[model samples]
Target: MAPHDLIEVKNLTVSYEEAKLPVLDGLNLSLSKGETTLLLGPSGSGKSTLMYSLNGLYPEELDGKLTGERFYRERPYEAFNPGELSRRIGVVFQDPESQFCMLTVEDEVAFGLENLDTPPDVIAAKVDWALELVGLSDVKEATITALSGGMKQKLALACILAMDPELIILDEPTSLLDPHSRQAFVETVISLQQEKGFGLLIIEHNLDEWLAYVDRCLLMNRNGKLFYDGSLAQGFREHYETIQREGIWVPRLFRTAYQLMERGIIDDRKEFPMELEAISPHITHGFFTKKVSYSSGIPHLSLENVTYKHIIHPLTSTIHKGEWVAIVGANGAGKTTLSLLLAGLKAPSGGTVTLNGNRLKEYRSESLWQEVGYVFQNPEHQFVVDTVFEEVAFGLRLQDLPETEVKERTETMLEHYGLAAHKDRHPYTLSQGQKRRLSIATMMVENQGLLVLDEPTFGQDEHSAQEIITLLQQRQQEGATLVMVTHDMELVDQHADRVLVMENGTLAFDGSPEELWKKGKRWLAHHQLQQPFRVRLEQAQKKGAAAIESARA
Candidate 1:
């Protein structure tokens, strides 16, 4: 192991009590202090498992068979005392709430310091410093449950920061945050790393927000083996095709640049641009394509002065048939609540929600569900059956379809979702990406007219997320209206016919995706929103190119 290495693993392997196959197999990896490394891999490719192993959770906190050697600070893992490893190597999980144990922000940050038997005076000062470092000093006494998703994430970081760990590992930390919050979170983490000089290992499916900050990249294959470890830019350039084929995400800018080069529209650059400003000078006339025009069909659902307690203010809107709508906003902005109201899952407190020509309240529960389907934010919440096959078939069976037809349709759905191989496995036993697929499969099996999905791509890999979107698009082509609550701005830019912006329990903006992007940056920032990477690139091309040309002249 290198002298600067904070943690090193040799011949590492871990296996859970499962049917077959170890989660991690013969993996060798290392992390050094004062460096930021972004971990990339297909969903369920053992990225999280590797994180758990590195932090000393394998074979102990987690019930597993571990066969390997790990070293910390050039010493063997066995040399550390109980709690010693965790104090030095802290992990922030995907769900921030899962790691929080205290009631308030101040107490939560202080909890870690107190556990180390820090003096009372030292605890208060450390808490303040950590909170300030994360920009949470004003909310120090706020209850954990009341904080927004972004705040909760910051608090989780603060807890780890207060402990002054040598290494900090974050697993999909920005998956639950909105676009603006995601940008802020990435900036904060990168800035903190620069100031504190802590080793950072982050795992994320989407690489847009992080590609600019992380200098090194580590990729793992589906078989839990290292694929590449090198400079971030060079790795993507050298193995672009291989990485793309492996179902890993390529930042949109890089993909666009590569596509343009392949089509002879632009020459290949030695380095991929990480910022919109860098992409400006390369813009060509062929780069600008005509915008797509979306048409609205007949209205399918309507909300007239809809208000649900304090969560949704009196809102009025119409959803047309054959339309794909995206609801986006900050954490407590009532996007999900609005979706629930539209799906007839929740009754509005003060207004009326209509389906077709009648009020939603007039229909029976069975009839209402037949027309409107809702997929929960957490995929596991909607799972009912034991096996993967049964979960997909459950909705079909509820329709009382013939056994033969049900079997055929269920098998087809399973095959389409790439779950045919694991049809016998319990739905709960599947990976996060697999569970999301099963949940959507169950909902789409019966062909409901109006489908509402919350964060459908939350835990998915690049390929799986694209597959899910394609499926939803197919259903839309079949005349199904879709309303999705998502934080993925790129998805909205590429797919949505209309966008809904929510803020403080009210509908702040409703328009086409392009129109939303046209709302100046100041306005978007006020609502805690930002343009997709593609739009940002386009803007830079239009506004920044003149300066480049002038300088060249």
Candidate 2:
């Protein structure tokens, strides 16, 4: 056993009761005290299972068979119950809704401390401390249902932090947060790591955001095998090609450097740049020099004084053709509600949405689906068929399209999205990224003029995210309008032609991506939207009063 290691696993194997194959097979992992490690792998690679096992949720909540040795500090795993493990290893799950037990923010934070038999006063103090750490003190008494998506995630982190565990394992903690909230959360985690030095193990697909903060990087294959474990710098240099080939998202500058090297456009004298600061000069030299101006033309889809309320409050907005608009806000900001209204899934409570001057209510539900395809946030929830091919072709099948057309469209979509190899596999058996692609393919099969996707890149790797961006770009070129609800600002900056900032079920700002950054910085901060590192770098390069303001803001 390593002296500084907080938790150690040897030959760990885990399998569910109903499954024939093990989810985790002979896995070994060691976390040292106060070290922050980033865990990277594709979906279904046992990353979540590993986090579950660390906190005793595997055998208990999951009804799984387990073998091999597990140790927390010096104690054996078998000696501790799930409750006992909670004290030593605090876990924040990927889905905020799943782990929340209490109704209010304050009570939720106090849940963990009270379970551990802490005194009332001590628990209260810890709750306050935890809330303050995550910047959730403003919503201490807010009901869980009233809090935004980012706010919910912050509350969950606060709950776990209140427990004061030695090992904190975050399972995609920022998976669903908007870009700004995600940035703030990552910064908060880095600060906590520096101040407390607790063992931090995070499972995340966004490697770029954490590259500067993590000390080490670990990769696991889909077979639940440990593929690599070492210092962050060494891993980036040695496994660069492998990571790219696997469709993992590395830092932007690193990817840019790799692409340039492949094109033989630049001399391969320097190692791949992992830090954002290092990539600034290269980006400024050529990348930002030739800026492509996108022309915004006629309105394709218009919302005339559109006002919609899910439970209460109204949201109204208009979208133009050839427009790649990102509808962004904290969770529950009516982003999803706006998407539903635009897709004709739900009629606006007041006002009207028009497609080519025709009122939305005038179109039949089935016909509306053909004109405006909507992809839900959770791909699994939208899946209806067993096989991937059948799932992707479901919409086409309903359209009563020719069998030949269905086959051709499904095959073309499958091949284009890299899902051709798994056409016969069950949709349930596919990885999270594959599932998301399948959903998009289904939506694309109809050639809808407008596509409304809620969190299109959720649960996807960097490579997959870029692929989706390309697919959306192609759709735009083909004259299909897109309205996406997202929390990823980088995705917005890279892909969106226009940005729609929402707040409390109202339209706050509707403009270009750069304009949003320039004008909505304070509003973005209030809503938990963090500016991208690229934008920050560009600001740093500028000089004078404007430059100072840009950098500071």
Candidate 3:
């Protein structure tokens, strides 16, 4: 290991019994102290497994086999005492609930310290310092269950900080947060890392926010091998095609600039812009113009004065056939509750929901299930069978379709969603991303006219997310109306014909994407939302061009 190396792995591999192959294979890597590195790869590419290995969770906490050497600060993992390794290398998992043990925020942060037999007075001071660092000091007395997704992640970080680790591994920490909240959380983490002087390694699929700030890029492939390990600028620019082909998300600015160059609309001779601020001077008039075009058809679903306890207040809206509507808000903002009411899964406390001018209450359970298909936010909630193939085929079999037809359709759905390789595996055994895809495929296989999906692309990687959205788009083009609840503003901007802004159990804004963008950043920020990347790029480009023209005059 090098003098500054915080963690090092030499030919490490992790294997689970349930999996057909090793999750990670002979990977050699190193992380330097105080360096901020971004880990990028497709879903199920062993990103999480690698993190587990780094923190001594793999083969120790899990029923897995590890064969290779891993070192922390020049000491082999086996050389150090059990709990001592974790204190030196802390981890913040994707699901914060998994790592938490105590019920209240204060108790949770101090749990690790108390276990270490630290003095009560020291624990108290550490708890206060950690919570304040993550900006959760005000909510120290609150229950863990009461916090939002962003708050939960912050609490998780606080727990890690109290341990005073030399390095922190964050596994998609902000994927569940809203656009504005996600940015805030990233900024807080970066600031804390700088102040504490700890090594930071974050795994994320969405690169829009982190590309501008991250120092190093560590990319893995489907084979669980590290392919590129270097600076972000060189890795992205030099290997753009491989990155895109693997379904890894290219920063939005790079994608747009590359496409324009390909079309001969922009000169390819100039250096491509990586950050939003640098893109404006290279921008041409109308280069990033957003052209909105959507057709409104007959009303497919309507909610009139809909009331769902205090979760959703009296609301009225009409969703037209073939139109895609996106429901977006901060966590606990009633986006899921409103979607439930729309799908006829949850009966409202008062008011009415109608389908084709017919009251929702009038439809039989079987009849309603056929017309309105709902995908739960938790993918595991909807699984009814063991194997992936059986799960997808379960609904088709209920329809009494011909065996041969069901077999063909089921096979096709599995292949399209990238689950064909895991067809025989149990649904629960699949990766989070793969499970989400299977849940969606089961509903889409039935070809329901109206689909209600909550965070449809929740755990999907760049490639898988695009495949799922493409399939949904195809269904919408074939006359199916889509109502999706998502925090991905880019998806909403590029796909949804209409946008529904939910805030504090009420409709804050109901309009087209263009109108929503026109509401200005301040109004959007007030609701805990931010403008999409494309819109930000367009604004920056205009400002940059204006400044250049003024300077020339």
lDDT of each: 0.85, 0.78, 0.87
- State the weakest 10-residue window (summed lDDT) of model 3: 287-296
Candidate 3 wrongly placed segments (more than 4 Å):
18-20, 62-64, 120-151, 260-272, 281-295
* TM-score, predicted candidate 3 vs. hidden true structure: 0.93
Instruction: Write one digit per residue (lDDT tens) for candidate 3, span 395-498.
Output: 88988999999999999999999999899999988877888999999999999999999989887788899999989888887889999998898889988999
lDDT of 1 by residue, 110-222 (tens): 98899899999999999999898777898888899878666787789889988988899998888878878788888988887888889999998768888867879998877
Error of 3 at 268 (Å): 5.6
Which one wins on lDDT? 3
Which tens-of-lDDT digit does each residue in 1-553 have in candidate 2?
A: 7889888899999886645688789988888879999898766668888888888876777766888888878678888864788787888877677788888999988887877889999998898899998877887898998776566778888887887788888877887777766777899988887788788998887666787788888887767777799877667667887776666667766666676667666556666766544544444445543223233587778876677655425545567777888888876677877888788888887887889789989988887877888888767778898899999889888989999999999999999777887898888766566788888888887889888998898878766677777888788888888889988777787778788878877777788888888764676788767676567767645534465588899
Residue 188 of model 2 has an lDDT of 90
**Candidate 1: how large is its RMSD?**
2.5
Pairs of residues at least 3 apart in sequence or in different chains that clash in candidate 2 = 178-487, 179-487, 180-529, 180-530, 181-528, 300-321
Error of 3 at 540 (Å): 1.9
Model 2 ranges off by over 4 Å:
13-25, 59-67, 257-277, 282-285, 288-296, 310-317, 330-332, 384-390, 402-435, 520-534, 541-553
- On a 0 to 100 scale, what is the lDDT of residue 235 in model 1? 85
lDDT of 1: 0.85
